[model samples]
Target: MPIDTTPNAAIQRSLRQCLSNAAFMLYQQGHVLETITIPFRGLDGSALRQLREASREWPACQQVLESSEAAVYNEHGRFVLTAMGRELLFDMFGQGAADCA
Candidate 1:
């Protein structure tokens, strides 16, 4: 389905949910290499794409970049979670699992 462009409360909530989903997806995959722009597959892309589609709803999600090796993007493509991103992901998954249990 095409994402709604019109701004509303639902869009705001979906945007936040998408961010949380993306963060959790990345965190579950764990920090492997050091690259923000790694070639992601599976759920990772879905999570990110969902957020991307809702970019207009939340601009903050755009700031959340993947961490990489050498402290910057380089030819050695490998991606890891940033310190802040990891913390956010941890909190998101932790709370989610706790709530489910």
Candidate 2:
């Protein structure tokens, strides 16, 4: 068998999935993932940290959000999803059972 040379690709896919899931959860609750505080008590600390890190480094995800002005840091230094973010969440997770209300 050949060596797995696509570790970063796999990680990126997983990161996108995780971030999409987190965004959907927040959308359902009319909230957004914030850096200043943990959005969900049940969310794994490491996963949350990874999501935050991806928000800064992931070009596809971060660039889209930033270009659309969807992801923004509030005055208190917390990352909150804007209205456009909700729309982007819908695109990422699909118009599934997650209510983006």
Candidate 3:
């Protein structure tokens, strides 16, 4: 199914249902998967995290930039924003993650 980026609740629901069913079918086939937030362009977590605490959610949230290089964090509950994300926030709001309350 085609994706509708418009802010329509019905369209969003349909897209979500489609994705959910696909994932469920995969799980039923014994191919379970977990969600992992990743950096844009598959950047290095070390390089990106240094720009900010990119592993803020490292404990509870799974973040994977590359399967070859992974940072194992033993904590959670904090939020992290990638360098690109920080730049976007700065460009959009004149505020980086550090400036946010």
Candidate 4:
């Protein structure tokens, strides 16, 4: 069967919110991107699929996340952000050096 690739505003909003929340948590906890997980919150199947799709389309998401065999084993993969991902997050979110430090 063909997949439905149509964009859903609500899903986009939810996904963006999820990423933003994750970014904030990373900042607050002072956890480096390598230690942080994208899609940090538990999501329903549909939302998880959406998150995966968003990661593909967004550079920041792509840089920050990667899918691994571990995800399949865990039933929910935890993606660690790369150094570039951390830099991109701070840049996109306007977080200052002090904020991260």
Q: Considering summed lDDT, which 10 consecutive residues are worst modelled in model 2?
A: 35-44
Where is model 4 poorest over a 10-residue stretch in terms of lDDT?
A: 65-74
**Error at 74, model 4, angstroms:** 9.9
Residue 75, model 2: lDDT of 56
- Which pairs in model 1 have colliding backbones? 33-79, 34-68, 34-69, 34-78, 35-68, 35-78, 35-79
Q: Candidate 4's error at 71, in angstroms?
A: 8.7
Candidate 3: C-alpha lDDT: 0.33
lDDT of 1 by residue, 1-92 (tens): 88666755565455446446544444554522222323231224444455456545323444434211111222333233434444434455
Highest-scoring model, lDDT: 2
What is the lDDT for 21 in model 4? 59
Which structure is stronger by lDDT: 1 or 4? 4
- Candidate 3 lDDT, tens digit per residue, 8-36? 66543443343334234334534322211
Candidate 1: minimum summed lDDT over ten consecutive residues — where?
A: 66-75
Error of 4 at 85 (Å): 9.7
| Candidate 4 backbone overlaps, count | 1
Give Cα-based local distance difference scores for all models.
0.39, 0.49, 0.33, 0.43
Clashing pairs in 2: none
**Candidate 2 Cα errors over 4 Å, as ranges:** 1-60, 91-99
Using TM-score as the measure, what is the rank order of every candidate, best first?
A: 2, 4, 1, 3
26 Cα displacement, candidate 2 (Å): 12
Looking at model 3, residue 69 earns an lDDT score of 25
Worst ten-residue run, lDDT, model 3? Answer: 65-74
